[model samples]
Target: MLDLQNIRSQFPILNQQVNGKPLVYLDNAATSQKPISVLNVWEKYYKEINANVHRGIHTLSQLATAEMELSRQKIQKFINAKHDYEVIFTKGTTEGINLIAYALGNSNWVKKDDEIIISYLEHHSNIVPWQMLCERTGAKLRVIPMDENGILQIDILDEWLSEKTKIVSVNQVSNALGVINPIEEIIKKVRKNSDAYILIDGAQSVVHFEIDVQKMDCDFFVFSGHKIYAPMGTGIFYGKSEILEKLQPFHGGGEMISVCTFDKTTYAGLPFKFEAGTPNVGGNIAMGAAVDFMNSIGISNIQKHEDELLAYGQKKLLEIEGLKIYAEKAKRTGVISFNLEGIGIASDVGMILDKLGIAVRTGHHCTQPIMDYFKIAGTVRASFAVYNTFDEIDVLVEGVKKAQRMLG
Candidate 1:
């Protein structure tokens, strides 16, 4: 069991007020609150060693490089990647998708008439990159459909997996609905049927689940740091070592080259080939602290705590009349997206909830396809984190009722 009081104490941001009431942060699906340890990492980096990483002999520069690379080791071990070089540092999940799409499509690996499959549950970050890639390479994009319950139609997996399928990109969890996707099962099928590369977007799932890229057997996996209690500007892209060696660089600049020449330039091996420009050294260093924070409490403990939050939040939410929670039947994490039956504007509901010191996300949540599938504009998403409590959820229930009364 997690020590709720101690966890809450680590996040000083949780101890605050909004609209003259105690803040109930339920927008964790958008981004998580950073703990004091992560904050201190940032402070220490800038104060003591603020220097660029790689090819530097100075003490501060060496320290910064060591810390940044240490962050990579932390991530590699965290995800159980076989080799540390397989873990390429990225801006976040979005850039990671964009990198792979650009590299594969441009390198003649994914040819014309080749297929790329994603799902209806994908964020625009996942969709738009592949769409751009398809437009450039003449590859076609296919989507796995989701039902009204917000669950993927697994029966159609065999149909979607074609010999022409070059890449199959799916999320481990849905950001909009909070549904836990059967990615390991999905990957097994993708491998058996097609000679396709698999990419699992773990932006929503990473903090709440134990991720082992080797166990999942995906060619690529991506997640963001800010979603997992780390600062913005840090993220991970884990690719198979052999697969990464086959791909060309997505960006060209100083560090990515082995030897620079006017005529021909040989690229660096593995990670440095892809990393290109000077990275976010400080942010990556602080990311190590975030990983330490998660490990200290144990991911299993955090997962258990968040599971309780999801259940309790759902129970309290269903008590309200006309509040229809999406994907209630699906296996989910610590997220809940719902809309009032008669009330159309999810934006207005969010605004009213804000007045009561409840923080929630109100939009299509970068998954307009999901909104279109549901035939609605958007939803009000109340996502929980480890620091959130059942008492905070009570406030959300009361706040929702208040919003309905006021909006009605």
Candidate 2:
């Protein structure tokens, strides 16, 4: 069990009030509130060791480089990558996915008529890059369909998987519906049926549980640091060393180069090859701090607490007169998406909730396909974090009922 008080106190933002009421922050799916430790690290990096990394022989540069590399090591261990070199830093999950798509498209890995698979539940980040890749490479994009319950129909992969499939990218959890996809089964099916490389978008899953990349055995895994209590503009892209070695670099610049001449250029090895130019040194170090913060409390405890919150919040919200929860029967973590019947739309309900100092995401959540699948405009998404409480869940429930009464 977690000491909710101790955990909550670490986030100073939770103490503030909004709209004349205590803030009930449930918009965690969009981005998480930075903990004090992560915030302090950001300040500390700039105050004590602010310099461009891997570029200078000065003490501050070395310190910044060391600290940033230490963060890389921490993330490598955090995700259980086989080699630290396999962990490449990026702007966020979107960049990581784009890196993969761009690199693969440049190489012979994906070619004309090659197929790439994604799911109907993917965020635009996961969807667009592949679409662009298909456009660039003449590859055909394939989608795995979902059932009425919002669960992925993994069985259909039997028909979709083929020799021409080159990449299979999917989210470990649906950002829109909070549905946990059967990635293991999907990976197994891909391995059995096709030679495609599998990439799991761990942007949501990383916050909810421990990720062992070696165990998961996906060819590539990507996530954003902001989703896991780190600052924005920091993210991780983990690819198997062999696969990364074979693919071309996403960007050509200083840090990712081995030798540069007017006539010829050679790229650097492993992670550095993918990570080009200057990076968010402070943010990446703070990402390491965020990892330390989660480790101190233990990921399992955080998962358990959020799971409880999900169950409690769902039960309480369902008791309302005319509320409909999407993916109600699916296994979920840290998020709940729903619509209050008779309300004008998710945005109206979200505005009402905001007036009560309760924050929730309104609209497609960058997932228009999900809305189109359900035949709805959008949903009210109340996503939780480790610091969130049952009382906040109660507050959210009451806020929803108030929205219904006012709007309906």
Best by lDDT: 2
What is the TM-score (0 to 1) of candidate 2? 0.99
What is candidate 1's CA lDDT for residue 136? Answer: 89
User: Model 1 TM-score?
Assistant: 0.99
Q: Write the per-residue lDDT of candidate 2 for residues 1-408, one digit (tens) a residue.
A: 799899889999999999999999999999999989999999999999999998999999999999999999999999999999999999999999999999998887988999999999899999999999999889999999998889998898999999999999999999998999999999999999999999999999999999999999999999999999999999999999999999999898879989999999999888789888999999999999999999999999999989999999999999997889999999988889999887748999999889999999999999999999898999999999999999999999999888888888
Over the stretch 113-167, how does candidate 1's per-residue lDDT look in tens digits? 9999999899999999999998988889989888888888866888778789899
Which segments of candidate 2 are over 4 A away from where they belong?
A: none
Off by over 4 Å in 1: none
TM for every model, in the order presented, reads 0.99, 0.99
Backbone collision count in every prediction? 0, 0
Q: Residue 163 of model 2: what lDDT?
A: 97
Q: Model 1: how large is the Cα RMSD against the reference?
A: 0.8
